[model samples]
Target: MRFPRSSGLLLHPTALPSPWGVGDLGPSAYQFVDFLAAAGQSLWQILPLGPTGYGDSPYQCFSAFAGNPGLISLDHLIQRGLLSYDEVVEASRRYDLNADQVHYGEVLAFKLPLLRHCYERLREGGAPDMAVAFTQFCRDQRAWLDDYALFMTLKEAHDGRSWHDWEAELRTRDPKALAEARTQYAEAFTLQQFFQFLFFQQWLPLKAYANEHQIRIIGDAPIFVAYDSADVWANPELFFLDAEGKPTVVAGVPPDYFSATGQLWGNPLYNWQRMAEDGYAWWIKRLRAAFTQMDILRLDHFRGFAAYWEVPAGEETAINGRWVKGPGAALFKRLEEEFGALPIIAEDLGLITPDVIALRDQFDLPGMKVLQFAFGGGSSNVYLPHHHVPNCVIYSGTHDNNTTVGWFEDLTEEEREVIRGYLGRSGSDIAWDFLRLAMMSVADMAVVPLQDVLRLDARARINTPGRLGGNWGWRFRDDVLNAGLAHGLHFFTEMYGRLPPQPEPDEPAEDATTEDELIYDPVDLATTA
Candidate 1:
């Protein structure tokens, strides 16, 4: 199903300014909703909200179904009497408030123990209602929560080592060892679950505020699971892993712009045959969990659904990979049978093939078109605005690209000429130029990275794909979100008819609807699904 013609910002919560070092589901989040409403944006897009593991990449999460406890608001915990203001003030002293990037290590060091302290308070029976709420949450989410909680508890006991690094019995998930670990680490398991509870409790209210302000969230979901994640650790059979819990094959893309050798993502490739045997149960659960926290979902690495690049384990690069067939239409058919409707956007970028396009169009799910990729060729280029169809989400750039300014500087003379000729303008305010083009396009959804709006350079780029460690750390100051910027965005939104209609004060938010808007309906197109 096509979304309303709307525009939004691609600012992950981590990019928001906060005294706590990293942005979170806190008061600053509510203020961001105010900013979006004031800017005439109807959507707020964010990266995956799962618990980050190595390199603090949201895409490489510890658990697909778990919320990032680090994003839980300490201030909210204080308000709930689970924590004290003194603790928050004390922890704030340890953070680098003036730094323009997130220091994930420092933030985690300060926040995790604090969350544990709050968990201790809750266990002490300081709040009866909260205890009941926690119990109910665990009960409702037991299907995934039980394994995730235990996985985290084990990770901590092993001094933050990967699941494969655990004792042989635990690595193999021997039944007796599992039972013993559960009995011994029961307290740790409770604390881990408690942290998840805090994350969801804070996040729901923030989502409600955004919904009330007419801004729907567009959260992300990666196509593959991390090898060190709870998902692969708990259900090894679902992934292509060896007996010792190592990936026999991994996930990545073939040669692309990011690297000559291609990016060896090292994520465990799915055993689609096994998934199909279970009716795609894990995929369904993961999607259902994502829906609880978002209105629309962006399916990352969407080409993988049609045909995935499978790299042999321990490969130096993704160059030595083979294209494997994914579940294709059959998997999506199963999802539709269970969920009724799917509001999804396909990230159909990088080394796309006709088969990928066929799969994307089959569901009528909106695909993405990044304007940065448009200058690579001519008018026949799919990313160009003129070629964009209404069933797509256009972007000036995404998290993986250099900022518009940086991209323009790095372009070859030939590529530069192409952009100037297509745009019919020189490089003055190139970021805004691209933004205007995207907003005015026929695509049903238009999203601009916050960096583009601020006209920041490459230094603010979020991720570089093949590179490691230095990505996903950029943050914007509170002052950058001034009224003038809002006016500029609002002006274009109004000009392009992307400004959402205001709902009456008494009406319920469109996002709060019970049933999700499915991507495919009974459109008896002679060719498509």
Candidate 2:
């Protein structure tokens, strides 16, 4: 469905400022919501909120349905009498919490032990209400939660090896073996469930607070699940796996302009035939859960849904991959039947084909347009504001791109001249220039990264696609959300007709009676009719 005219910041919860080594669902999250509301934004876009695995990338998550435990607020736990302020402070002191960027290792070390402590305390006769709530949450989410919790427990039991690497019976998920494991690691399984409960307990309320302020959240969902995820382990038949549970073929892009050997994502390719047999039941469950956490979902790597690249499991690069037709309309048709009028945004950014366009148009899912890609071509460029359709989301720059300022600075003189000529400006404040372009564009939605809003440069770039380490760690300072900034952003919002409509006053003006004007009362009309 088409989105309303609105603007928001694309800052992940991890990017929010905090005293802890990493951002959490604490005071800063609420503060950011206030900032968005003050700026007249009706949307808040964030990256995937899943539990990151080896690379610490949200895209590579351990479970598609699970929340990131790292985002749970320890202060909230303290308020619940599960942890003490002194213990939190001590944990903070052990890490370099003052750093502007997240050190994932330090954050894990600082957070995990405390999280376990909270779980242990709660396990040993905690508050009655919380205990009841925990039981309810687990029961309500058992479709995926039980499998996920057990998967995590077993992973920890086996020194963090992937399920395929475990002993035969456990690797194959034999019923007897699973039962034995569950009995042996009962506490660990419950602890995993408790962590998930804390994550959603904090996140759901935060999402509701955004909705209360008329700010809808746009959350990212990767098209492919991680190879080592609970998604794969729990439902092996749905993927192209070998007898030993290893992927026979993986997901990636073929050679492209950017690289001779394309990006080998190494995610397992789904067995579309198998999934279709059950009418894509797994996808239905995944999306249903996603909607609970977010108002709108952005389907990442959307082209893959129409046709995806399939590379052999041991391939060094994506050069040898072949295009494999995907489930296309069948999967979406089922999803739409499950959840009517999907509030989805398609991440149709790379190498879009006719089938992908057809699939997107068929579902009426809004595509994305990035200002950073506008000047690379002439005025005919689709990314240019003039060429944008209203059924799309426009961004100054996405997480993958450098901040608008950094992008402008890195451009060649001719490229810079093209941008300056297009906008008719000196390009002194390029970030705002891009921001204004996005706001004034025909796209239904406009989203700018917080880095662009703050006019930070390359150092603040969220992620560089191919570079493995030191990504997704950028954080903003607490004091940056000033009143003046809100006022300025609000000006653009109002100027571009993106501000939400205000409610009419309860009392109207006491004016002289006008005979021609008739105000019909709903109650009178209903009774008369």
Candidate 3:
């Protein structure tokens, strides 16, 4: 989809500062929104907000349609009278909330119990209005919520084993066993729904606040669902599963410059023929749910939507995979019919084919460009700002890439010289230099990672693909954001015409001096006014 000429910062909510051992949809989130407004940012991009499983990767979530309970705010519950401030304070004492990195294991241990306590309070007839709202939320979201709540309750019963490892009756979803299990785990199931209710209860208001400040949110959605997810378990027939309910083929990428053996992502491949029988109903619902939380959705691995790499289930690496045709235009046609003019940004970064470019252009969706990739080759590199199209979204770096400074530090001296010569600078401030290149480019939108904005190095990188652990743990300190930082960023934003046009100034009184007039130079006044 075409976007406004604007810029934003890419920082997952997990990176926000809080005293709860993890960033959440609490006061700090609102403060971050305020920062975005002050910085003249028009977008707030985030990773997927789904509940993470074994690896704590947002992309591999428990449910495509559920919120991550780990992001719910207990302090918000205190305001609602479902939790007390003293209790929250006491709970905060058990974990290192001020740590620079997230301890996922400790966060889960600390959050789940308190979430359950809030659920119990609601069950005990506290907060009648919220109880009513919760009931309405469940009813409104029943199509997906019922299955997700049941799936989570069952996972807990089985000690966190994948559904494929469950008994035959439950694994295959035998009706009699399913009926009995629901009755026995009714409270647990309801509690899962309540957690979702609280997540959206806090999230929607935060999203609205960002919107009110003219800052649109861009949320991520993976092209493939995890094999162990509720979507796969609840609707096994939609995937290429064998008789025993295991995937026959999986998703991954073929060998490329990055890896000789290629990357094998063990996600279940979709049975496109089966899905088409119902007019791609599943994808429609998934996108519809995603739109409820975000203004624009970034489709991860956009090339996979045109043709995906399919490897037989037991393959050790992606070298043995073959390209298989996806649903392509038919799937997107159905989505557009449901929600017109798809507000999507395609993650068309790696190994893109003509067909993928065709698919993206057919929908007029914006693809991405990362400045970190530009200096690797000559002028023909599509990532270079000179070759950039006005329909793309530009970035200084992405979640998968190191901070711009770190990337520059690791480059060969010759490569560094090439970049410096191209930009006509000595590369003293690489992060802001990259940011300036991105903002001054013709791309419709530009987003810089918060780590790059903070001038952090590799130590603050958000994620590094293929690594098993220690990814998705970085968080920024609370003291880093200040008025000077906002003003500095706004200078670039305003100078590049990314900020929205300001209204004309009214006539000033004889002794009046407003904040804008007091702070800005006469040149700034002429430009802004």
Better of 1 and 3 by TM-score: 3
TM-scores of the models, in the given order? 0.93, 0.95, 0.94
Q: TM-score rank, highest first?
A: 2, 3, 1
Higher-scoring candidate on lDDT, 1 or 2: 2
Please report how far candidate 2 places residue 153 from its true position, in Å: 0.9
1-529 per-residue lDDT for model 2 (tens digits): 8888888989999999888878889889999999999999998999999998787899999999999999998877888788999989977887877559888878887898899998777768876667777786777678788899999999999888898889999889999999999999999999998888788778877886787778999999999999888999999999999998999999999888888999999999999999999988888888878887789999999999999999999989999989999999999999989889999999999899999999999999999999999887687999999999999999999999998888899989999999999999999999999999999998999999999999999999999999979899999899999999999999999999999877579856445322111111112112111
* 10 residues in a row with least lDDT, candidate 2: 520-529
Which 10 residues in a row give candidate 1 its minimum summed lDDT?
520-529
- Candidate 1 residue runs with Cα over 4 Å from true position: 95-98, 256-258, 412-417, 504-529
Tens-digit per-residue lDDT, 1-529, candidate 3: 7888999999999999988878888988989999989999999999999999988999999999889999998777888788898988888778766568888888988888888998888888988767877786777778888889989999999999999999899899999998899999999999998888888777777887787778999999999999888999999999999999999999999999889999999999999999999998888888878887898999999998899999999999999999999989998998899889999999999999999999999999999999998987688998999999999999999999999999999999999999999999999999999999999999999999999889998999888888889999998878899999999999999999899555458845244333223222222112111
lDDT of each: 0.85, 0.88, 0.88
Candidate 2 structure lDDT: 0.88
- Deviating ranges (above 4 Å) for candidate 2: 507-529
lDDT of 1 by residue, 1-529 (tens): 6789999999999888777788888778888899899999999999999999879999989988888987887877787788889878787787664458888888888888889888888778888778877786777667788889999999999999998999999888899999999999999998898887777777776776788788999999999888888889889999998878888998887887657888788889999999999999888878777776788999999999999999999999999999999999999999889777688999988788999989888888999999998876557888888899999999999998999999998889887877888788887789999999999999999999999999999999999876869888998887788899899999999999999997689987465422111111111110110
